[model samples]
Target: MSLKYAVLAALLEGEASGYELSKVFDVSLANFWPATPQQLYRELERLAGDGLIEARTVPQERRPTKRMFSLTAAGREQLAAFAAEPTRRPTAVRDEFLIKMQAMDGVDPRAVRALVEERRAWALGKLARYERVRERLLDGRTEEEYLRDADRVGPYLTLLAGITFERDNARWCERVLTVLGERRAAAGPAGPAALG
Candidate 1:
């Protein structure tokens, strides 16, 4: 999907400044769809030019007036149309680390282990953050309430997706660690795992 669609999705939450959208992109959309603030700002301007989004200047007391953007009716229609179209299967590498691990018989196991450990730590930390955000959004409501009555569905659903993806990563890390340990023991004292 294009960045345009992602921008439209973000605007669906509510009107927001480019800065605010940038924050949303960083937290909510960074997992499946990553975009820099420069790209977001440029796309917002383009969407405005295309009459898909409306921008209004909100005056501030101290700082400069900020431009807030919201989707126009046309933008909403376009989004609906995009959603109605057939979903295209994205083609990309399924897992680079798995490939590296598979070749570890000849490759360096310690290097692969290092990479896995680093990624594990990152995924664990991000999962913790997502959990915190999910709790804050729910505010003690039950799961059924969170699923049925939440106002901000985009963040809500995306946050769940992020949580699931990170959880999967953590599992993969643990499996890899276990497999590495087995390989290390099987290799005895002079293994590639200990060489690095």
Candidate 2:
């Protein structure tokens, strides 16, 4: 999906300045659609020009004037119409890391091990952050309570997906590291080819 649709979905929460929207993307939408601040600002302008969203300028004492945006009726209609469209099939994976993993046999095992360690660290960090978000979303309630009474469920559901993805990543990295480490142990001081 385009940044346009993402922005519109964000505005569905409430009116917000471009800065606030950027923060929202960083928090709630980061799992699905990551956006740079520049991209978000540009999309805000385009959405305004298209009459999908309405903007109001608010004067500030020290900072620059802030423009708060909200979805117009047309924007809601557009989002609803898009939602009605049949879901597309999942896109094919196009990741470079998979290619690197595939070539690990010919490449240096040390480098691949380093990559796995790095990915594991990143995945663990993401899982921690997702847990924090889940806690905040739950507040003092249990999961069942939150799901029953929350105003919106999309963010929580997407966050769950991110958590699951990160868990899988960490698990896969651990498996790769275990295999590589075992080979290194068996080969003693031999080179990568002998380790294989």
lDDT of each: 0.85, 0.86
Rate residue 122 of model 2 by lDDT.
Answer: 86
Supply candidate 1's per-residue lDDT for 173: 93
Query: In terms of TM-score, how similar is model 1 to the real structure?
Result: 0.85
- Candidate with maximal lDDT: 2
For 1-196, candidate 2 gives per-residue lDDT tens digits of 5678889988988899999988878866877778889999999999999999999999999999999999999999998787688866563445688788988886678888899899899889989988998999899999899889999887788788889988999999999999998887787766545434
Give lDDT tens digits, candidate 1, residues 4-69.
Answer: 998998898789999998998887677767789899999999999999999999999998889999
The local lDDT score (0 to 100) that residue 104 gets in candidate 1 is: 64
Lowest-sum lDDT 10-residue window in model 1: 187-196
Ten consecutive residues with minimal summed lDDT in candidate 2?
Answer: 187-196
TM-score on alpha carbons, each prediction? 0.85, 0.87
